[model samples]
Target: MKRILTTFALCSAMIAGSASLPLHAADAVSNTSAEKVLPLNQRMAKKSPEWLSRGIMYQINPRAYTPEGTLKAAEAKLKDLADLGMTIVYLCPVFVADDDMNREFWSPRQKKSQMDSPLNPYRMKDFYHVDPEYGTDADLKSYVDTAHKLGLRVMLDMVYLHCGPTAVLIDKNPNFVKRNKDGKIITGPWKYPLLNFESPELREYLFQNMEQWVRDYGVDGFRMDVADGVPLDFWEAARVRLEKLNPEIGLLAEGTRKENQLKAFDLSYGWPFSGPVRKVFVGGASAKSIRDSKEGFRKARPIGGDRIIHFIDNHDISNDDYENRTEERYGEKGVNAALAMMFTLDGTPMLYCGQEICDKNRHSIFGSKFGCTINWANAGSEEAKRRQELLRSLIETRNSRPELTFGELIWLDNSAESDVVTYLRKLDGKQTLVLVNCRAKPVSVDVTLPDGVKRHFDLKDYEFVIE
Candidate 1:
């Protein structure tokens, strides 16, 4: 879920600054530029599917999702996800990883070993086949089918920006790759070959590959990786071509581009909000910082700010984060509060795999090692069951209460003190109000409601209420 193009900026602003958020929280824009607006027809070609708009997205790293590490095993858990009330299941790239570490590569982990690791799902070796390590081609199809049967849409994550060193495309079609002035291959980090967008045939090849996933595997859409590296024109053209095959197919981008970027896709990641929320609940920032940052995002994209997917924990932040995972940083109780706000606040919320169980083991971003896989035992444990119930109830409210999902946001004036922040959401003649306490100690706050109920109340730290 974390397809970070500017990891340094995110690491500095989120992980390091988690202890104390800077005053200007929304200034952290990645690969930012003045956007040239597109024509009205292209800008509003499609609205995000209603199911997706109201749904809470869940990111699944199939490799480490369970002990079996196969799609069949993942298929078995479809009912569990359905019970959690998740509407979307986004699986990381099922494509083969470069098993041949014969070529040179360097990981951000600072390790100098020349060994093969299947941890990085962003690198692809073959687009046609599902990773044998994960499962056979049939296994993936079955997984997607099961998701659909359980009333969940599946988004297959695609790594289209670059390919692994031993990627089949490197030698199979040299014309499809980016090359330097001297004619040698242009290499990104880890010596992976960058794709040449200028090649029409290459673009066509990718478009068809995308179609195969939807047509053959029965996936609903794709969660594109490093979308910023690919030209905007290419994406718009690709969307036009692919939608013919399935108009309902949604396109989700990982980068944090502005209005022009949103024109080509249905959704984008709200990564900028990550650190500020942590700053409020776990770090020392005030509750007002959350409102300030969200307001900044709203100003930037007045048309479709809610399309950005928001989350407390995702694959990148949970697995290979520069700082500790959300569980460790926020602790168990703090996680509940952070997630509660994520579900009730702006945009479509997301939950990373294993979060329901409060999974604590951190896997290497490069690959999973001993003792790092998700603990299935927690799935039936009391703590995990409690979280499942909490998440289910939150999602139930989000769906049952239209104001919670599609309402206009209005911060309650002076309704909260330093430790608490309250806001009201209104839509379709209904209103929903939320109050969250980020403090660790119980405190009383004077607050007024729309129904003329005004009172002071005490709340435990990281507690919240929706009315």
Candidate 2:
């Protein structure tokens, strides 16, 4: 229980800067973080690059983003994403996808086999090679280089838990995979075989490959899928090794386990917290529920909560099903309300591709039998243009003002209505009053502000107002 740069501390160092003591420095207190929470600035006088705290990441599936569905094609949109206030561009799996397992899946025209399901990007065929469909290794380098030029960091999608049914490891080193009682390889729900992390050789293999992505492609971060499935010891050991190679590179875990944030990962998705935010708009949820949820999450954090990745829709959640789409599930206004909550909360925000334009289609990177690519033409349409501007404004509010990203919440009285939630984000002498009406219909409630503070109160259905 001595001073140590645990994963939590590393994440804080990337956000709160040198002012933050190493996470384990509080040896006298419980490791669960018994210390009293302080205001954003007071908690740490220094701050990391503004991008880490105010970061807004836009996720793109290279194979589903542009009609060409290649890294080169997606590179053309980097500047646009940057303009949208995205400091990080996360590409969903650029490595070679398992073609052997997808022989039955057809290509765009029903002319050839696509060889894989969009739901299974984790089934990698090669740890080092870029997918033929996603262009050559040079294309990935160019993509990362373009993002860097735009002042953007590139986060690669990594899947270490498993490989494709026909991965080379399955043949060359079958011992690296898990075997069932029947001596058959154990597979996940998607039929993808699982890797055996107990094997030191396998761990080294994955570690070296992840290192290659950072060193070779200059990737700034890695979004590991199903991180909890891997042994915590391995993640911790690998993190120590990887960070020594490049201290600035970051690691993001797709899992929700809070303990994962305490040690091995720099960031983890706030999957549990996201449910309450989305439910608040779906009706039946009260303002108290949202307040309680946010407060609890803030208090429960073992380190800087800013490391949490908040998002309304992601590649995995933004499925092809209508019920899962941002437009159909939450609608434009609901999506905006969610954004208001997500950005104003203590976390790094993320925007899925087409989310800025209120894109209706869910991302289906690879066709099971037919093609379903994003229509690039939407970026030019009138509705898309409006949404783009709206999205830009929402993110700018978070990035331009330190209070929004680092502020402590001062919940305001909203007893007048259950459908409405109001609060103030105050820090560094700046304050932003956020009022959100979670109902499907407009609510006109008379609101009283603190002395010398002023804001508009009239709210439309599912409208989020920041003043």
Candidate 3:
């Protein structure tokens, strides 16, 4: 049976005339000739000049980023990455893997039991320390320092769902891990041993570790992994605790589930919407399917005033599962359009490590050590060059338009026959109309802008412009 989920949209509708918060007008610049964009949303009104609500984000897999394979090397590329319009840099997994080489590599005996990789950034071997392979403690400090110097906020990949077999939680405090009926620890791939959040000791340890990261490293925030597995109460508690460390410390959840919304997560992965949208845009599914999935996501997810991370593909798809097949289906042209849609929509966009160059090398965390590296050689290709530039432009466009970031989305199905997906983002007093053609040919249709919109600005260069 198909499952239907209820969202805050319905809940708010039920309360109708009753107001929860006031909708304030945006200070979006009325001057069309202005060269630079302004951050005028309600959320950013009180923030510092460096405060960021909408901008580009870059994802770097340290191991694959450079031959040196160290945080220092990743730091060297900050300038290049910043040039691409990155306001944030998300490092996948920087913590040390299992110390023992034999224990680190996944073997036949451990395959079924492991839920993640020995190198999985989600499984922490040491909370207070940095992985020697990635870099020393000082090296990590430099990475964060350089990122901030470059005007980019750094977010660490916080994997709290589980820990490694020989981690402090498992060896020192056996009570920290979840156990089965027979008192045996429940195991999964990647050797993930679940944390016992019910225990105060375990909860305190996790919270303290989080607090240390904020106070010591000056890390901007956390990109929590497997957020769904953790207890909601634990997160709500963490949210309160984390704010004490740094009120500006952002919270981003890796999972896309309904229950995550009511708690402390500031941003959620729009996976349900992204997957179906990509499939439909890539010709794997029908336009009707895309529309239905988007409608479902809108109805189910309580995303108003909160950020949702939108993407065409991340490491899970770009590096592993969907790698080999994506190029054949979408080709260079199709992927560019897909990136445009992902970045321009009403969400914070996420770019997987290799997506900038159409890295279709089938990234593998379990494959050959050197094979895991990004094929920098592919950057010379025309297709790769085009995609890279297209992504940069899209991100730059997003940075220039605050309305696209915090605005409300109004999807327009102008010509389903032509496979065109269009939408208008309205925030404060600014509005942007984005039209993305998913089909092979150019699709055109007359679009009516909101009253007085055409008189103030021009949007014709864009697919569905007002003036």
Name the candidate that leads on TM-score. Answer: 1
Q: Which digits, one per residue and each the tens of the lDDT, describe model 2 over residues 1-467?
A: 11111000000000110121222221232223332354322232112334555578888876557778888889998998877778998888878767663533322322222424433456677878888887899999998998899999988888888888778777768878899888888876556778998788898888888888888888887888888888878887877777777776667888755456555676677675566666665545665566665555445345453256777677666543423566666666666666667776656788888777767754565442244556566768886776676667677677776776776556665443466666666776777766667667766655545553434455666766667
Q: Find the 10 residues in a row with the least total lDDT in model 1.
A: 3-12
Instruction: Give the higher-TM-score candidate: 1 or 3.
Output: 1
| Candidate 2 ranges beyond 4 A from true positions | 1-50, 102-119, 296-300, 320-324, 368-371, 445-456
Predicted candidate 1 versus true structure: per-residue lDDT over 10-34, tens digit per residue: 1101110111111111222232243
Off by over 4 Å in 1: 1-46, 110-119, 189-191, 260-262, 321-324, 415-418, 446-455
Stretches > 4 Å off in candidate 3: 1-52, 99-118, 188-191, 300-306, 322-329, 367-370, 442-467
TM-scores of all predicted structures: 0.85, 0.81, 0.79
State the C-alpha lDDT per candidate: 0.68, 0.65, 0.60
Error of 3 at 345 (Å): 0.7
By how many angstroms RMSD does model 1 differ from the true structure? 7.8
Candidate 2 lDDT at 318 equals: 57
Regarding lDDT, does 1 or 3 come out ahead? 1
| Per-prediction CA RMSD (Å) | 7.8, 8.6, 10.0
Candidate 3's error at 239, in angstroms? 1.5
| lDDT score for candidate 3 against the true structure | 0.60
